[model samples]
Target chain A: MSSGIRVASLDDIPEGEGIAIDKSVTGTADDIALLRDEDGSVWALDDTCTHEDASLADGWVEGGYVECPLHSSKFCLKSGEVQNLPATKNACPHRVEVRDGEVYLFPNEAP
Target chain B: MSSIIEPATGSGAGPSASGGERPVGAATAAPRGALRRPVEMNRNIDVSGLVDAEGGLLDRSVFTDEQVYRQELRRVFAPSWLFLAHTDQFHKPGDFFTTYMGEDPVIVTMDRNRRIRAYLNSCRHRGARVCRADSGATRNFTCTYHGWSFDLEGKLVSVPNKGGYPESFDTKDWGLVEVPHVESYRGLIFGTWNPEPVALREYLGDMAWYMDAMLDHDDEGTVVVGGVHKWVLEGNWKLAAEQFATDWYHVNMSHTSALTVLAPSGKPKAEIVHRTGRQYTDPNGHGAGFPVHPRNRFDAQTVHKWMDYDALRERLGEARVEGPLTNGHATVFPNFSYLPVNGSIRIWHPKGPDRMEVWAWTIVDASMPPEVREAQRLYNLRTFGPSGIFEQDDGENWSECQAIAHGFITNSVPLNYQMGLGSEREDGRHPGTTSELYSDAAGRGFYRHWRELMNTPAWHEENR
Candidate 1:
């Protein structure tokens, strides 16, 4: 079953960008990739990339794709389809919600 | 496939492209470079017999024969794909870096399109290297030997005798001939003497998986940083790559000095390394992986002081840190090694049969803070660059190894690669999906393929 929770509010992420927060869920120290769409909504995903194990939160966000900082491999932020050849697999996107002007991530063990 | 580029897997070629003195292709008459082609022992080679469960025995002739060396230049170095500098090396339009494609000097540049291009360094008219500054921004390359200028695209834009030459000499036909095909598998650039060769990525195969890790998978995205540290060393190209590819066994002895500096406890170096990962051999005979780090000597030196042991723990998390902290080295066949140390990529490229010109670059996340970049570069230079204590010392021995092997006696006697011959474990089991590194896994794998390529005709494939 997929865990659900709130991560951030609309004011947290400005337009045309992304934010990275520590993930303490999964019972292991992990990264939570937090991104806000132009419409000002909260989204979250696993920060560790499956391809090269690099942190996806540190990657560049443009349009709707996140370009991995290492090799320029782009992944669609909305769905995490590996948008390039260098990366063969998709990133794990997490579920999120915005409640009371705060972003709370689901399965919120905060890993 | 008519291109003169050497076959990557299929070692055999027709008589014209044959390995040795057996005349082949446009090279049948005589060689243009310092070396000559081999006669491929021009028979239908049975590669099966050359190597075995142990590995191929590389005749010293393979390393020192002037004729065989020439043959390698043509069949191996000439046609095969050789790496050039990375795209990031040339940051500006006029930026250029000079490297060798065999003995031929080449200048890699960034054109107006920001696309990468390379040209034979020799001038079109008088055959002198058109430009020489090691690396810098130049609007165009003007031949110092005789003032012929060419643009970054290698188009012969200026010639002295514009109107003087008879209608015979055409400027359009004399453009700086590009080095066949130039392509980047990730940010790593490679070129070939032939008109075309396989895509660089396809040539890498499973090797690409690790290359992605070394070049891409990082928080900030790794980059080619500081600058390349170049210095000449005396050693055959294959010898150098072979040393890394399959000769982990040699590290205990060949680099015994490293141990003295590293641990200095009078312990066996190999055991102290804490190496893991399967030492795999690609179908074409390329070798990779020797997961031996954190514990890798250089890392051991820095982990406590420079690198934040805890920050690293937080960043890499627990999985990667404990597992392949020293991920197996990723060898790029022939003569290249992608040394990814937790988070750095060091590249090695050979210039000729002996005497390799090294190019060292650090791979780090693009978003890395400058201090991190500086630390990585310093670590890279300290361990492998010219200033590198290890490299400078290794060069003295490697070059001397070739020079001492100069006589017919040393060249004729076969070198013994028989270490742990019967005990080497097979590919039966492993987590890293690699061959065992307990033995000289890289050495056996490299020599076996060297003989296959050296013996097989350039035009023939085992199946074809």
Candidate 2:
């Protein structure tokens, strides 16, 4: 039984950018990063970078990946896989659904 | 002198001289009072018998003893002025670089007042590392563990749950531990943990005259081109330091294959090996060995085009500029060393009695053209970087020496350092004691100073 939380609207995050959802709102272990690709697809992953204590919400989003702002480690938005050095572990990805322009985050559930 | 070099009489079983056994259960003890205090160990090991400076003999146990390595961290490194970083690395307020001083992690920062300072990187609360990045600019270093924030000056500015603490809990008492002394000379920043260290220039002594040829060529000075390169080598840190200080004789033998393969400047091996040079040994433990007339081994034509010979001769006297130009290495006492020809400066960070981590940087004059700087960077990488041709050869010898140094039979044998022992003389040209190129005067001087520091517990007791 999966419960969905209405985090934000589809238009809340701009193209090639990301925003953070606090853990208090999603009830997850870490803050969630809501990223919007250039093609208008939405993805959700843990906000904290695996290599260091830095918010991925402040990172730059492009194509299907987000580059960490602290050490520049990149992570795939769709599956939360690490793409480069300085970071080895994959980030935790969460499920997201868009119903009539409203973004619903299935906290702690894999995509 | 005979007593100092006496053969080890003990069976070479466990820790000798100091009868205390190595603590095995200390790590598992419950953390109660003074959690950050280091484990207590026997510091009185009687190091006077380890080095015979004038007789030119050194005991092998200095390279393998755990007690001696710990004492060195306190007596040798704590009071000495150690190089931290170049001034160019800090251009504005909040610029910072992380480095180590005898395994103690330090954060060198440019405060908001534009003054440079150093602090122990461990947080005041729980001793967690406050800054983790290698180099960056930031206004506040916030601890990720519990949200304790410190300003650029290392003052604890904010803490979570301000109302939870008692009214007597003042934030002023919780700032990061600051290094007591910090100074700079010729753009190189140095710091010391001693509350009252001698002035930087005074401690450097006449070694500054020899360094001016490479550091003070232009009015703008020099800047580090590429960021630092760090790697670990399985050897005693002193092996690398002593080699850079006093052992140019090993180059022709150890690096013969490299010299033959690279043939830098297209010069024949005979021409490069036949050049006569001099070795300088300073009373302050600094040492430099360089040829009287050095040929630019890496592209002489390009170097000639970039350097203004007449201007350099006018600024630094012809005697100082001509000798010690290119193709030489010098060490500033303990761990900091540099090679002029390779455009590399490094610190030999000791990991233990048998291992070290090298942090190196390629430095070039700020006045050089972009192409020249790029050439220097590439040349440095090819010659002295971790996987470079010459470094691999040097690392092999050092690691092998360390492996043999720990053996019970080998540890009883004394290493001879008697090459040119009585040949030191005053040339009136250079400031320090000068000897033949292939001499171990500088190596002897290094051990002499090391013995002095090990025997004397306080800086005030030093005869300097």
Candidate 3:
């Protein structure tokens, strides 16, 4: 019972970093961070850090983990599990698909 | 979610035989007769939901509830081991200091026997405080109210008018009530009122290993320098205690503006956020988190680094010196906490549910040269005393949070504590439950212990 939306093209995001897309996970237009790992797989999570009101897009992404720039709390790119202290809960993980060179997002599933 | 809290309406399960009554040594306005009567708290106020399956739950009532505070005075503060004074504070046999066990005023002393003891500050006859001076050396204390004099051992020595009382009135039965359990570890003194309870060593558990990092740095040991600094904050005591115990996350955000000025180099704000540290949580509600430096870069300028680092390494070994004693904050159970390198030890004395009196001291190596000790003292005051840059910012955050929790709806909402949830690991270098530097696992552990003590009225080792 979810819907898919086209968020970006394969060429729109860099291979080892993430870009913020102006789309919401639950249809109300919230910011979602579209991250491309070094292995070339794209993952989408809510741009906001769950611990505090910081932006995940402004954080540093490396080795399949995104480190919150404000306090350095890390979140895993694959499982969305919080990788460090300060942020105790998992970030919202979204499904991503690349077809016909266009990146699609399915974000109704909760993290 | 099925509520784990028993209905506040029902009697629920009470504590063991010794638990139903409010144990002696806790502060109370009522006399002994009233204390003996059973107090029925709001049984319907189930706190099971206060902590959640995800990691943390918000129950602002713990801070604002009148009923809950009353329970804490009995169920939590009464049996818990509380900080009394430092060992060096009273070196002479007759030396004594006045302090608090919860809200009750007490006198901690080194009697003629040279044994450390604590007694209720209230005079036995009329309940007025017997000892008035903050600290001094006196053979005995005389009650200003009625001239009832007590010896250094807290024994009733003389009464003004002997004819006023009957012949059967023995002075032996009228001495100030002594605190039941008194214990010391290294140089710190702690007391409790539970008649039969676990020893302080068992109560502190593995946290003692971490504590040695600060207390056991050298064979000469640590001493309290620069007397004491006292202040009042309009916040709950638990907020202050919990922050020191497990809230390293708040440092980068709350102290950002202050850190900018304190940074050794230019662009201080950037330096504050770039550092890394690990958090440790214990089953006993004790937690500590400290920044791990590459070869002691953080303390390079301090007196600690000036001392023999190689000697410390030889004494405590590499892992201990790096893990617990380096550069961070720690708390022992309820209220005693300290910063390792910064060297400020404090007790958050609870005054009702929303207020606390902070009694702080600066700790330094007793054997250090006078100039080096003075340098350490000045640094401590500059960094963590009442007027310190970091201390001011921390007090503001706690006070503001307390103000918001007073709201009707806001008090019921759970606060977010989900940083680094389910991502804890077992690292040989670190002890207890180890997690990433930014996780709230320590906070969760702290609250879990709080919940356990709040629910169980007794202070048995099993319950702890």
Off by over 4 Å in 1: A1-111, B1-55, B254-257, B264-277, B292-330, B342-354, B418-433, B455-464
User: How far does residue B440 in candidate 3 sit from its true spot (Å)?
Assistant: 1.4
Every candidate's lDDT: 0.59, 0.79, 0.75
- Residue B251 of model 3 has an lDDT of 79
Error of 3 at B88 (Å): 0.1
True-vs-predicted CA distance for residue B222, candidate 2, Å: 0.4
Q: Compose the digit string of candidate 3's lDDT tens values, residues B95-194.
A: 8999998888999887765667788999888889888899987666777776676777677766766578989777766777767667778788888877
TM-score, every prediction: 0.64, 0.74, 0.72
Off by over 4 Å in 3: A1-111, B1-46, B269-272, B297-305, B459-464
Evaluate chain B of model 3: give its TM-score.
0.88
Residue B394 of model 3: what lDDT? Answer: 91
Q: List iRMS for all predictions.
A: 17.6, 6.9, 27.3
Candidate 1's DockQ is: 0.01
Every model's DockQ: 0.01, 0.04, 0.00
**Per-candidate alpha-carbon RMSD to the true structure:** 19.0, 12.3, 31.0
Better of 1 and 2 by TM-score: 2
List the candidate 2 regions with Cα displacement exceeding 4 Å: A1-111, B1-42, B264-267, B294-301, B459-464
Using TM-score as the measure, name the better of candidate 2 and candidate 3: 2
What DockQ does predicted model 2 obtain?
Answer: 0.04
lDDT of 2 by residue, B175-223 (tens): 7766656677777777776655677789889888888777888787888
True contacts kept of 3: 0.00
